[model samples]
Target: MTRTALRICPLCEATCGLTVTLDGDRITAARGDRDDVFSKGFVCPKGASFGELDADPDRLTRPLVRRDGVLTEATWDEAFAAVQAGLRPVVEAHGPDSPKFSASLEQGGTPIAVVLGNPNVHTVAGALYPPVLLAGLRSRSVFTASTVDQMPKHVSSGLLYGDPLAIPVPDLDRTDHLLIIGANPMDSNGSLCTAPDFPGRIRALRRRGGRLTVIDPRRTRTAKLADEHLAIRPGTDALLLFAMVHVLFEEGLVDLGERAAHVVQADEVERLAAGFTPETVAGPCDLPAASVRRLARELAAADSAAVYGRIGASTVEFGTLTSWLVDVLAVLTGNLDRPGGLMFPLSATGAAPRPAGPGRGFALGRWRSRVSRHPEAKSELPIAALAEEIDTPGEGRVRAVVAIAANPVLSVPDGDRLDAALASLDFMVSVDPYLNETSRHADVVLPPPPPSRGAHFDYAFNALAVRNQVRYTRPVLPLADGQPDECAIHARLILCLGGQDGADPALVDAMVIDTVLGKAVADPHSPVHGRQPDGLAAQLTGRDGAERRLDMMLRLGPYGEGFGADPEGLSLARLLDHPHGIDLGPLTPRIPALLRTPSGAVELCPAPIAAEAERLRGRLGAVPDGLLLVGRRHLRSNNSWLHNVPALMGGSNRCTVQVHPEDAARLGLTDGEPARLKGDGGEVEVPVEITDTVRPGVVSLPHGWGHDRPGTRLGVAAADPGVNVNQLNAGRLLDPLSGTAVLNGLPILLTPVR
Candidate 1:
């Protein structure tokens, strides 16, 4: 029998709705859901091939345990036993004495744990269970993909609004002018700032007579569609942005509008912008002084304007400074907290509007990594330092790792070293569906069922959506017999870490519900202020622990029902009634309530940002002369996970260095000929794709490759394994403020392979 099921595409950040044609347990086809509230029938290449990815033969169907130093198929019970046996000794013998930071290590209990994947935000099990597992393990040496990808933005948002989660996204649908820096929304389909059909949105803006400008080192797809493409030098975004600010201040275009009353340190911002004029930075940023002035002037003159920067801007030497300047420009032009400007997204699952007041503001450097003492940003250590923490000998050095859906060997810098470090771990476990580069080193690998066999929701992406909306999908296919869902797999892992190896996973969910309800009932602001925790638990509805938890969260969320206080308000039941999704509407002005700073106002000139600006000023005259390397995004792939799927591996998805014709000629490199690209860490000989898309002195390679590692079970990915670009990043260069790897604009030397 053929049946159609609604599912949210978990391939990327776009989170578009998908309709799957299923035959029993098999997913036959996938297409855009026309009735979806947000995407509205728009689907990308990654979304369209959902069925093929879901049914990939490379996916592991059973747990694998290392017996006799060789990974072999094992039963779930045997896998759990192996995990408990492997991790318990490491935790008891080598755990850090305290969660707090200290210069000297005093080890006692709780082995080091690290979560290093982007998939955590893409799936339900990924979003819900990692925190519980981490809490159970209680390790201070935490690491996530954020540091390598988007930690700078989080740090900048924390410093600006006093809350790291209080990120403001550009109002793409209504904006009159959109200035994008170092972002290819057309390729990524929008990241951090979630918007479905990003290319269509750009076209819509153009059709509506809105000016669109893109500033990047390469002429990306997004740049090709823009009104102007500023091919600025890599690692110089902060300089270019500060120069724009200088132009705004110099021309008397600084207007805060309503923000004037809620903003602090406007004068300090002006002082910081004093010396970084367009002329001073033009030489470093590779942008003309006239063009800088015109961009600033056009932004100030626009009916509404927004300055948005993404990964390219965030993963640089001056990442935090560049990120802060993005918002600084938005505020200076009076485009913040207004329609057609940069605004906060109110997700359905987010908390209800709280009283606008001072909050316990966000903080950084609460602790530092063991090896390098890199300050923790947003409670995560720099992923670049993961190798040292494991390899370096110390009292509190990382002895064990619990990696979930992560492939750090390909994703992180210096993969060769990290690969050896992983082999040296006292214990290692990976919760992933494939035995790829990273998982191949694990003592026990717990493979989660495919997306088709698991329910789906956009917990993280919804909070970052350009528009406020909510949608969900139950599992399209039944779980294979004896194959646990991801949630169950994660729950079991948490139980093992907590020393309750065989405990019912549902107890974890129940305990969380009781704790949340107990707190809510005591709070005067809660709708069920005086309600008993037991009563609320009884009222919750779901088929499983994960669903029940989701129900409780939805009922208490901003758009939720508040447990009958607002009958028509959101709930799991309410959402289930609407399969396509319910559009909560567009983003609105949210400022005072959103600001969590100690002063309860926007901190335009945070001291950290100002300090970094001074450092940026010091680099105005020192421009390195070499071929700078940057990573490019493919429309078909999302990091390292999709390469195993054969459907996404052809055409433009191939791994080859993108070099300009002029640069290729200068290096004596011919098209389709191999070239040795050397960087600080190492070198790789990759075929050259000569094109004018990149600037003359720059080269580009796509991230998430290098599938050639031995003992890996990924048949498709290992067949014609592509080179790993992160191998060139030795994990030496990092943004001091956020500890983000300088993935873009790093100087490299290229030589043609004879």
Candidate 2:
């Protein structure tokens, strides 16, 4: 029997490198690629189950078409024809703007052509695929995960650094102090970045005389590792951040010289922060005033410090403001754009990568709908209004939709309403591997090949990588029988939509292979590059060589010769000589010579963010007295995709409402009892998990569950389906400026489900 070694793990954003032991054509066992420069042999349980996802009984091996309200197995050509027939008329009658496309940020598998071909599509794949597509689509009716979750960071980054994508990452390896707010890196690995072996990094931080502090409503895994954990109220991160800034300014502790010239609206920031003393905002934030003051001082006294925030900061009523304030605090403390402080990651490739875009800021008491008008932001009307947009009689109505790799019925706000809107669509198509809740409504489902068959690139995560390192993986196995290449399938769909294909598929495929090998060959940063060429080649082949090609492209790319560039340094054949992985050094901050703003200096506190503060105050007056809704995360699930992987799903049930003990008592609900969570658009009955981890009056429900589709063959997910929290989350209640749906801090009534 013949053998081939390969490394490719598509579990989460971590994208950990793996080495599969192949016996002839069968994959026998998988292990972490020991010499992988990025992950460094850190493989999670999900990575171990790659073969399971490949051979799972639930895997869709063939295309299925809906005929007369029934789905039947069909040939790829037949399925393509059906998709074209169904979607063409909708685009013709309603215009391309009628369709909306959404995808996950975990992987950039969607072909660029599909997104660029249509002016109407939208997605959540940030910094990587979206920019490439945005350059092509140029449509105003766009929505992404950024606005709904990370817009605050983008807005904040823009205010502090002139570039919205210049998000500051905490230098865990070098910093003496780290202040984390509203983010749980432990569970998320690293939101907006690929930080594999996070626990190990945290441990290293402590070993190097660094101290970590966490400010969150829950004592998350990341918090447990911290030297101190401050349990504050949700949606009050901005106030907390502002209080910290106030402390820095009042005590003459601020490094004004570093930011004085670049600082815009300094007077305004000082004035706003003056009103938010620790004592003044402590009551609303539910944290001790003295502790807040102490934290501010400690952060200031440290040799080097950085502040970081994520989904917890962005998904709230004041998400954008909170995100902005975190950056403000970083800038005021002389931490912005500094080593051992808040720093930006440089992209290896020549591509100009911006982590977030500056959308329109917040809008005031905008007209809300009776059914769900949530506010409009950045021209994307609230998702809650999706049903209305589809059903209401009017011009430019959403008559059709083409969702790529997203299950809005379970993932988006007002899932029930979105489901209804989907059902009402004149035409719909889903590019997914399963018949999920959203896909069940599609006229045709265009399934892409498994991750093992596609090339690997952390195009999105590279800009946010904890360490500035790059690696690529080729597929360990060949494309499964009769399955169209993922890119080809997407290209065909885009062509069907009446648009010209951009990149040649063959070129892309070859480039992907070349890029992976090139990176491996040229990587001076890799520990094994000079020693283990065969192992490197095995891994590069698994990544479809895109990783290698991307590295090569970056070296010769517009950026000009990254750390690994050398004419005689490396090649694909050289990588084939090694079998172990390679090593890249720790990531560091990089600010390119071209700042791009009118002024070369970083813009501290830009005008757009200052305007948003007033909008936030006018819209969400104060925390209401009802159960405040918030979204929570889990380590195993990667939005809607991971539910299909049995290994990740074998653990304890992850979907449940985390209610405060006091609140659970008031509602007469015990642990394990069902609670009916009601909002403006819909309601869902979820099992209660009474825990003091949550603050009183606030209830937490895990996002990305509630799979109720009869057609989906996810046996584990179907058997243990949880409530679709998005159903209760009406998109109509949105941050008008950013057009981000308020997924957190929405008022909802809860009662024990008898």
Candidate 3:
């Protein structure tokens, strides 16, 4: 029998709707869901290859336990028993902090450490269960992929709005002018800002008379379609942005519009930016002074404009400063919180609108890592420091680890060190679907069932979506024999880690529901405030504990029914009724209510942010001279995750260094030949793709390669194992504020491999 099922693609941040053609339980084909309210009829290559990826022969179907120091297939019960035997001793005897990626490590009674990967936010269980698992384990500390990816943006948003989660995205559909720095939405499908069919949207913008400008070292696909491509010097984004700011202030273009009443410290920003004029920074940024002035002038003159930046800007020396300046430009031009500019996306699952007022402003550096002494931001230690934190023997050294859907061995910097550190752990477990680079070192590996056997939801991406919307899908296929859904894997894992190994998995969900409902009823502003927790629990509905938990959340969410408070509002039942998903409409201005600063106003010139300008000013006119390394994104790949899938491995997805013809000639490098690219940490000899896409002094390598480790079972990835670009990262260079690894815009040496 052939049947069609609707599912939101979990491959990337775009979160487009997908319609799968299933033959019985097997997914035969997948295509864009034309009726989807938000994504319309758009599906990227990643989405199209969903069936192949889900049915990859490399996917582990059973748990593997290390017996006699060798990983062998094991039953779920045996896996759980191994987990209990492994982690309990580490928690009781050695303590959990293991030297502090987590502040609770000092308090110690929980698990040693838990590291989450980028894929966690992509699924239902991933989005909901991680917090529960961490909280239940009293996890001394938690490390997420944020430290290596988007932490700077969170830090900057925290300092600006007094709430780290109060991030603003460019109004993509309506904007008149878009200045994109270090981002290739056409390739990435948008990160931080989630919008499906990003390339089509860009095309739409162009057709609608909107202008798009890109500022990056390499002319990415998005840049090729741009009105102007400013190939600025690597790691000098902050300097170029500051130059624009100086131009805005110099030309008297600092208009705050409605923001004038709520914005503070404009004069401070002006004084700070005074030193980074176009002329002063032109020599450093490798961009012309005239171009910088023109960019600033165009932004101010545009009917509506926005500045959107990504990893290229955030993974640099002044990541937080650069991120701050991106928004600073938006605000100065009176474009912030305005239509066709930047606006806060309010998800259906987000809290309802409230009057603007004082809030508990976000703070950083509550505690420091015991080993590196790196201050914490949003409770995350620098991922680049994970290897050192584990290998450095000291009080509270991490004796055990739990890695969920993460392959840090390839994702983070200095993989060789992390790989060695993982081997040294007293005990480690990985909740992964593949025996890949990182999980191969685990004492026990529990594989979650295929995506077809798991329900889908976009809890995290909803808030980041360009348009407000809600969507949900049940499992497209029943779980195979002995297979457990991801939610069950998580719930059972938490139980085992917490020393309640045989307890009912339902207990985990019940405890979480009670905890949330109990807190909600206590909050005076909550719709269910003063409502009995038991009563609320009884009102929830779902097929299992996970779904029931989802029901509870939706009932309590912003657009939720409030358990009858608003009968027509959102609920799990409501989402189930709309298989194609419900569109909640476009984004709107969220100013006073969105600001969480102590003053209940936008803090334009935060002191910590202002302090960075002086450091940036110190580098004025000091031009960089070397072949710098930067990472590129391909339309077919998303980090290291998709490489193992054969369908996604060809075309432009191959791992090779992109070098300009000018730089190649200088280095005596030939197209299709090999080059030894050396960096602070190490070096790798990779094939050179000579092109003029990149600037004269820079080189580009795609992130997430290096599948050549022994004992790994990735047949496709390991066959031609591409080199790991992150190997060149020393893991020491970090943004002073965010601790994000300098993944891009760093000086490196490139020589022809003779």
The parts of candidate 1 lying over 4 Å away from their true place are 94-110
Model 3 stretches astray by more than 4 angstroms: 94-111
**Count of backbone clashes, every candidate in sequence:** 0, 44, 5
Candidate 2 residue 709 Cα shift, in angstroms, is 2.9
Q: Candidate 2 on 120-191: residue-level lDDT in tens?
A: 121112222333333334333343445556665655565455555666677776778988887777777767
TM-score, structure 1 vs. true: 0.98
For residues 1-754, write the lDDT of model 3, one tens digit per residue.
Answer: 9999888899999999999999877789999999999888899889999999999999999999999999999999999999999987665554443444244455322337789999999988898888887765555456789988899999999999998888899999999999999999989999999999989989999999999999999889999999999999889999888888999889898899887888988899999988888988889887888999999999999999989999899988899999999999988999999899988998877776667898788787776676777778887778887887788876656668899999999999999999999999989999999999999999999999888889988888899888989898898889998887899899989888678889998998999899989998998878898989999999889999989988887888878899899999999988899998888889988898878898899999887788778887889968878878999898889888898888888898988999888878878989998999999889999999998899988899999999999999899999878899999988888888888888887889999988
Clashing pairs in 1: none
Residue pairs of candidate 3 with colliding backbone atoms: 98-396, 98-397, 98-398, 99-396, 102-141
Worst lDDT window (10 residues) for model 3?
A: 101-110
TM-score of each: 0.98, 0.83, 0.97
- Best first by TM-score, ranked: 1, 3, 2
TM-score of 3: 0.97
Per-model C-alpha RMSD: 1.7, 7.6, 2.0
